[model samples]
Target: MDEHYEKETFLLRIQAINKTFLENHQRAINIIAAMVAIIGFHVYAGFAIAHDFHKALPLFVLMLMTYAGLLYFLLVKQWLKKLEPILQLTADVFSRIWNFTLFDISICKVISVIIILAAFLVWIIIDSANSRIRLRSVGGMAMFLFFAFICSANPSKIKWRPVICAVLLQFIVGVIVLRWPAGNEAFRWFSEQVVTFLNYAMIGTAQTYGFASSPPEICGFSAVFIFSSLQIIIYFGAVVGVLYYLGIIEAILSRIAWLMQYTVGTTAAESLNAAACIFLGQTEAAILIEPALKTMTESEIHAVMAAGFACIAGSLFSAYIAFGACPTYLLSATVMSASVSLAMSKLLYPEIQESRQKDIGSFKFATSKFSVIVSIH
Candidate 1:
C-alpha cells in the first residue's frame, strides 16, 4: 500500500510538470493578444479619421498592420516551437511555383528579383483606366496580367480558417494599439529604440562575418570601425548578449514569420528564411530550414535563396537605402522571392508535407577561439 501511494504521488508530480510546461507559452500568447488589441484600435481610429483614404488604399494599411505585428512577433522566435503545428497548416497554402529552367539559386536570385521589381515598376508608371491618372493604362494592365499569369502557374493548398483568424487578430491588435495613446507610444518606442538597434547589430555582424560591406555612402560611420576584426567582435558580442537579454531579436523575427505565413504560403518552418536573415543572412537561413531542403519542392528553395539575394537583413537596410539602392526595390525583391519559391517548390517536389518544428529553434551558438597569429613577411 505504501508503494502504491508513492507511485500515485509520482504520477501526479509528472502530470503537474507537464501542465506547467504547456503553460509556459501562454505568456507569449497573451502578449500577442494584447498587441492585437492595441493594433486593432489603431487601424479603426485611422479609418474613423478618414474613411475614404483608408478605403481607397486598404491594402496599404493592411500591409502596414501586418508589418507592425511582424515586427513585434519577431522578438519571440524561441517560443515558436509551440506554434509549429498551427504554423505549418497556416503556411502550406502560400507555397509558390517551381520553374524548371532556373538551374541554380545564384542566378535564379537575379532573375526573380528583376521579374518582381519590373512588374511593380510597370504598375507605378502606367494607369489602369486613366481617370485623372498620369500613368499609362496598358502598362498597368500588363503588370496585373503578369502577376496573374505567374500565380496561375503555381497552385497552393488553401486553408482559409487559420488565415482568417490570424488576419483578424492582427487587425484587432492594430486598432487597440492605435486607440490607446499610451500603447501607440510604447509600440513606437519599441520599434525605434529596440527593433532598429537589433537590426543594426545584425548588419554589423553580416559585414564582419558574411564578408559584405556597406557602400561608402552607407558606411560613413560604420565603415571606419568595421575594418577592425577586434572591434567587430566586441560589437557583435554585445549585440548577441543584449538581444538575448531583451528578447527583442526573437520577437521581431517570429512576427515576420507569422506575417509571411499569412500573406505568403509556406509552413511555419519556412520562417527559417527570416530567422536566418537575422543572424546567418540568406544562405544561413537555408541551414535552419535544412530538414525541409530535401522535402521542399524545387521552387521553394529558389525563393529562399532569392530572398537572401534580394533583401539584406534589417542591418543592411539602412546602408542600401543610403546608397540609393532603393528601399522598395529590396523589400519587394524579398517578397517576390518568397512568392516564387512556393510556386517553384510545388512543381519540383510535389508531396503532401508534414511540419518541421524541431530543426529551427534548436540553434546552438558555439563560440570559437580566436588566436592572434602575426608573422612578418
Candidate 2:
C-alpha cells in the first residue's frame, strides 16, 4: 500500500509539472509571436515611409516603447511573478536527476536582463541615428534566426535567452574590436609578439631541418617553413598542459564559464567547453570537460559540437598567418566565433530538457605520466 501510494503521488506530481510547463510554454509562444508582429510592422512602416523613417524615428520609438510597457505591465510582469515559484519547483526536480544545478529566476536576474536589453536598444537607436543600420544586415539576421528556428529540435520549446545574449555580445565585441583604436593597437601588439615568437622557433627549426631555401643557392624572402612554423602548436600544447596541471586553466575557464552561464544560460561544463573551444581544438576542449561528457544531455552535447564547428583554435592561427591571412583579423575572428558558435548552437538545438552535467570546480588532466606524455606529444 505504501509503494502504491508513492507511485500514485509521483505520477500526480509529474502530471502537474507537465501541465504547468505547457501553460508557460504557450504564454512564451504568444509573447514571441507578439514581438515578431511588432518588429514586422516596424519594418513595414520603415519601408512604406521611405525618407520619413528618419523624421518619424522618435515617434516610432515612443510608440514601440509604449507597446512594450503595456506588454510588460499587462501580461509579462504578472506571468513572471507567478513563474518564479514554478521555475523553482522545476529546478528542485531537475537537480535531483541532473548533475548540475539550475538557476531560479530572481529579481536581480530580471533587472540584469532588462539592463542588457536597454543597452542594446540604446545602441540600435544611436546607430540608426548615425545611419549605420543597414536593411540588408537586418534581413540576413532575420534569415539566420529563421533557419535556426526551423532546425531546432523542439521549436516550441526553443529558448531565446542564450541565443539573444550570445548574438548581442558578438555584435558588441565586434564593434569594440573594429571601431576602437585601443583594441586595434592591442591586436597589433599581440600579432607582433606572435611573429617574434615564431621567429625564435625558427632557430630550432633551422638546426633540425636547415634554413628554408629555393633551388640552388637562392634564398627565399620568407623564412617560414610550413612544418617548422606549424610545430609551434606542439610547444603551445605543452605549455597548456602545464597550465592545466597548475589549475590556471581551470581557474580561467571557471571565471569565463561563470559569465557564460548567466549570459548563455548553460551549465558550467557546456560554458567551459565553449570558452575553451576559443583557444583549443574541438577534441581538446572536450577533454577539458571529459568527466561530464558521458553524462551530459543531448542538448549539451549539441552545444559542445556546435561550438567546435563554429570556432577555430589558436593553434592554427600561425598556419593561417603563413597562408597570407592577416594575424589580427584571424585573432579577432577566433574570438568573435566563440559567441557565434554559442548563438548558432542554441539556435540549431535549443535546450528543452534540463542538462544532466554537473558543475565541476576544477579539472586536472596532466597529473599522470601518460597524460603528460599525451599532452606533450
Candidate 3:
C-alpha cells in the first residue's frame, strides 16, 4: 500500500508539470496568432488603399487609432498580463542569437572578419554606384575612424560587436532614406505633415499677439521662433505628462531601452537615457534615469551624455522646421546619430567596472508627485 501511494503521488506531479507546460505553450501560440492577425490586416489594408492618398489617409488614421487602442488596453488596462513576458522572451531569443560567439578557432575568426569586410565593400560599391563618391563622404568616414582610434579608453579591451552593429544599423537607415524612393517619399510626406501641424501654433500666436496679417519677422522668417517654441513646449509637456500618467510612455520607453540594451550591450541606465533623448531634451532624458545616476559607471554616464548631445528633442523639431530646415534630413540625422553616439561613447569610455544595473527593466523611472496638469506646469 505504501509503494502504491508513492507511485500515485509521483504520477500526479508529472501530470501537473505537463499541464503547466501545455498551458504556457498555448498562451504563446495565442499571442503569436494575435500579432499575425494584426499585421496581416495592416498589410492587406495598406495594399488595398495605397494607390490613393486621399482615400488612404482616413484608413491610415484609423489603423493608427486601432493600434493605439490596443496598446492602451494592453498597457493601461493591464489586459493580457503576460504580454510583457512574451515580449521579453522574444527579445531575449534575438539578443542571444545576435550576441552569440563561435568557438575561439582562428579559422572561424578569419572567416567572420572576411565576411564583414566583404559586406562593407559591397555596401560601398553600391553607394558609389548610386551617388558620386564625394570628398565629403570619404572625409566623413576617415574622421569617424580617426575619432574611434584616438578616443578609445581601453584599446585592447574594446568590444567591437556593439560598435559594428551600430554602424551597420546607421548605414541601413541611410540607405533606406536616400536610396529607396518609397522611403524617401514617406519621410518627405511625414515631414510636410509635421510642418503643417506645427504651423497651427503660429496661427494661435498670431491671434494672441496680434501678428495675424503681418507678423514680426526674425532673420527674414515669418514665424517667430520664441512664440512657436513656447507653444510647442507647453503642448508637448502636457501631452507627455498625460501619457506618462497613463504608463504609455514608460511602457514604450522600457521596450526601446530593452532593445538597445540587449542589442548594443549598454547598461540599463545608458539605454533608457538614450531612448529618452530621442524625444526629450538632454536634461529631461537624464532625469528619466535619475535614480540610477549615482550608481552608474563612468562609461554609462558618458553614453547618456553623448546620446543627449546627439539626438534632437521632439520639441525642437518645430524650431528647425521654422528655420526652413528639411525635416526629413533632420529626422534621419537624429535617428542615425543616436546609434552612432552610443558606439562612439563605448569606444571613448570603455566600461572597466561591472555595471550595477545590467537588466533593462531593473531601474525605476522617475515618478511625478503632482497630478498630470501640475506636472506639465
Candidate 4:
C-alpha cells in the first residue's frame, strides 16, 4: 500500500511538470526575446553606422522586415478567429456553488487551469502530431463565458471611499494649481523646498545607516530633498488642523447638508455628517456631528457608509506615492471618491419624504494638542 501511494504521488508530480511544459509560454517568451534582440541590434547599428555605409546598409533590410512582419500578422493574415476563452461558466458554477465563497471559485480556477493544461496537451498532441492526432470541437467555451460574464456583472463588495477620495483630491489639487498658476508656482517652490529638506534628512538617515561616506551628500540642497518628503504630509496636516480650528469644516458640512436635503435626496443630518466624514477619517469623521445617529434612518446610515467608502486619508498618501503612484492621480481619486460617495448615497436613498434638521454639534480640539505634542516630542 505504501509503495503504491508513493508511485501515484510521483506520477502526479511528473504530470504537473508535463502540463507546465506544454502550456503556451511562447507568447511571452517571443515578445521578450524579440525586444532584447531588436534593442541590442539597434544600439550596435547606432555606433557602427558612423564610419561605413556598408554596415548601415542593413538598416533598409531591418525596416523592411519590421514593416513586413507587422503588415502580415496584423492586417493580411486570417488563420484563427476560432480562438475561444479557455475559462468558461460550467466549471465556474461548479466551483463557486453560487457565490457563497469566492475563494472557492478561485481555487477551482487554479485547479482547472492545471487540469486543462494537462488535458489539452494530450488532446492537442493526439489531434495534431505525427503519431496519431484527432481534432474535435467541444461545447465548453460558451458555458465558461456565461459564468465569466456573471462574475463580471456582479463583483464582490468594495470599500469605495479610498477610491473616491483619491480621485477628488486630484481634481481639487489640479484646479487649485491651474486656477492660480503664479500662486501655485510659489506653493510648488515651497513644496519643493520642503522636499529638499526631506532629501537632506534622507541623506542624514543614509549617513546613519552607513550609506554615505561624505558630508556634502548630507548638506545644503540634499536637506531640501529630505524636507520635500516630510513636508507633503506635514503641510496637509497643518491645513486640516487650521481648518478644523477655524470651524471651516462645520460650514462645509452645513452647505453639504443643505444640498443633500434639497437636491441630492439625503436627510439633512446624514449629509452633514457624510460631508464632514469626507474631510475626516472614517471613525473620526463620524464624531463631528454625533447626536443624529440614534434616530438616523437605514438609508441615512448607508449614506454615511457610502461617504466612508469614498474618501481616503492624508496619512496614507506618503506611502502610496512612495510606491511610484502619480501624485495628481492619487489626489484626484480621493476628491472624486468623496463626490461619488455623496452621489451614490443619494442614489441609495432618494429624498422624497420630509427632511429632518440636526444641530451642528461641536467636536473637541484634540488636533491642536496632537500637533503640539508632535512639534515638541
Q: Highest TM-score among the candidates is held by which one?
A: 3
| lDDT of each residue in 189-259, candidate 2, tens digit only | 66766666555555666666675521234464564456465666765676677777666777677778778
Evaluate candidate 3 by giving its C-alpha RMSD to the native, one decimal: 14.8
lDDT of 3 by residue, 1-377 (tens): 99999999999999999999888799888898999998898888878687786757756876887789788887875855658888789989976665566674455445676798698777777667756655467579768867886878888777776676677667777877888999888777777676666666667766776663346676775645465577876667666777777778888888888987777777788888888887776887887788899988988888989999999887788888767888999878887887778888888878888889999766798886666445422
lDDT of each: 0.51, 0.73, 0.78, 0.53
TM-score of 3: 0.71
Scored against the true structure, residue 104 in model 1 reaches a CA lDDT of 55
Better candidate by lDDT, 2 or 4: 2
- Candidate 4 lDDT, 89-156, residue by residue in tens: 55576556533436444555445446755765665566466644223322343343334334432224
User: 18-46, model 1: which lDDT tens digit per residue?
Assistant: 88976998888789999999899778767
Q: Which stretches of candidate 4 lie over 4 Å from their true place?
A: 1-243, 252-263, 349-355, 358-377
**Descending-lDDT candidate ranking:** 3, 2, 4, 1
In Å, residue 259's CA in model 1 sits off its true spot by: 3.5
lDDT of 2: 0.73
**TM-score (all chains, Cα) for each model:** 0.37, 0.62, 0.71, 0.35
| Local lDDT at 30 for model 3 | 87
Q: Which of candidates 2 and 3 reaches a greater lDDT? A: 3
Model 4 collision count = 55
Candidate 3 Cα deviation (angstroms), residue 241: 2.2
Candidate 4 whole-model C-alpha lDDT, 0 to 1: 0.53
